[model samples]
Target: MQAVIIAALVIGIPLAIYCVCTVKREEIFEEGSGKNAEVLDDDGKITKETTMGRIIKMDKGMGEFLMANGLHCVTCTSSANESLADACIVHGLDADIMLSKIQKYLDENA
Candidate 1:
């Protein structure tokens, strides 16, 4: 019984530590390569289908607006996969209103 417990601890502790390290590494890579290096469409317009990461990549300043609107996951890995419409749905926000605001901001800034 003691041997089993020791073996379990030995295996489990290393496994847990490895998982944590792996996650941190992936986060670092995602932050550097995934978020900052993403390319925007040639038109550079914010549409419902535009991913949050692409929006931020197009204009980092947009992140502030998104956060203010309670869509603060702009920096998260999931943002790379999530579109404005999906994010708005998940956050209980009106997608049309958000898209309009985003386009207005882009127009003014451009």
Candidate 2:
């Protein structure tokens, strides 16, 4: 029994640590990738249904804006699947207001 417990701990701890490190490394790579470039094309529109990952990929500067507004999860892998409204709800922010602000940012910056 003791040997089983020891083996589990030895395997579990390293596996857990590796999983955490892999997630962080992926976040770093995604953030540094050319996908995060500032050059916006026709697809750069911000809408409530637009995924947070799509927004960030459209322009890295927008990611900074999102982080400032407490949506720091923009860099997370989950953001790829999370829309602006979904993220705002999860973050306890008013989705409409956040969307408006994001629109204004795009308008003024564009």
Candidate 3:
């Protein structure tokens, strides 16, 4: 009886974790679904991923893009709470231009 319990603990736990990790992890990173369209780049790459459904998944590429374009606020932790539109408004950055440039780069590379 004890041997069976030990075997079950080892095998069952691993199998359960594997199944949960594989199945649940994909759901966490599917995509955005709001009206904002997830702030895609010129080539349809996700710039500011707005899908805060399960966990935070900000588009790191967008942050790099903003920093490259002189928008330093992209690195701030506060950016996690703020939307792309609001950040542009506060930082006096042109959201359209930034987005356009990002998308263009994406299109070219893709």
Q: Which one wins on lDDT?
A: 2
Per-residue accuracy of model 3 over 7-109 as CA lDDT, tens digit each: 9999999788667654543443344222233444465455443322211243324344455776555434444456555666777877667656655654554
Highest TM-score, which number?
Answer: 2
**Ten contiguous residues minimizing lDDT sum, candidate 1:** 31-40
Q: Summarize candidate 1's per-residue lDDT along 1-110 as a digit string, tens digits.
A: 99999998999987886676546434534443222223445565556888775666555466666778788666455566789899989889999999888878767766
**Displacement of the residue 54 alpha carbon in candidate 3, Å:** 13
lDDT of 1: 0.68
Give Cα-based local distance difference scores for all models.
Answer: 0.68, 0.70, 0.50
Pairs clashing in candidate 3?
Answer: 41-103, 42-103, 42-104, 43-103
TM-score of 3: 0.42
lDDT of 2 at 54: 67
Per-residue error for 94 in candidate 1, Å, reads 0.7
Candidate 2 TM-score to native: 0.60
Where model 3 places Cα greater than 4 Å from the true spot, the runs are 1-61
Model 3 lDDT, residue 14, Cα: 75
lDDT of 2 by residue, 1-110 (tens): 99999999999987886677557635644564334333334675467877776676654477678879988776566566788899999899999999878877767765
Better of 1 and 2 by TM-score: 2
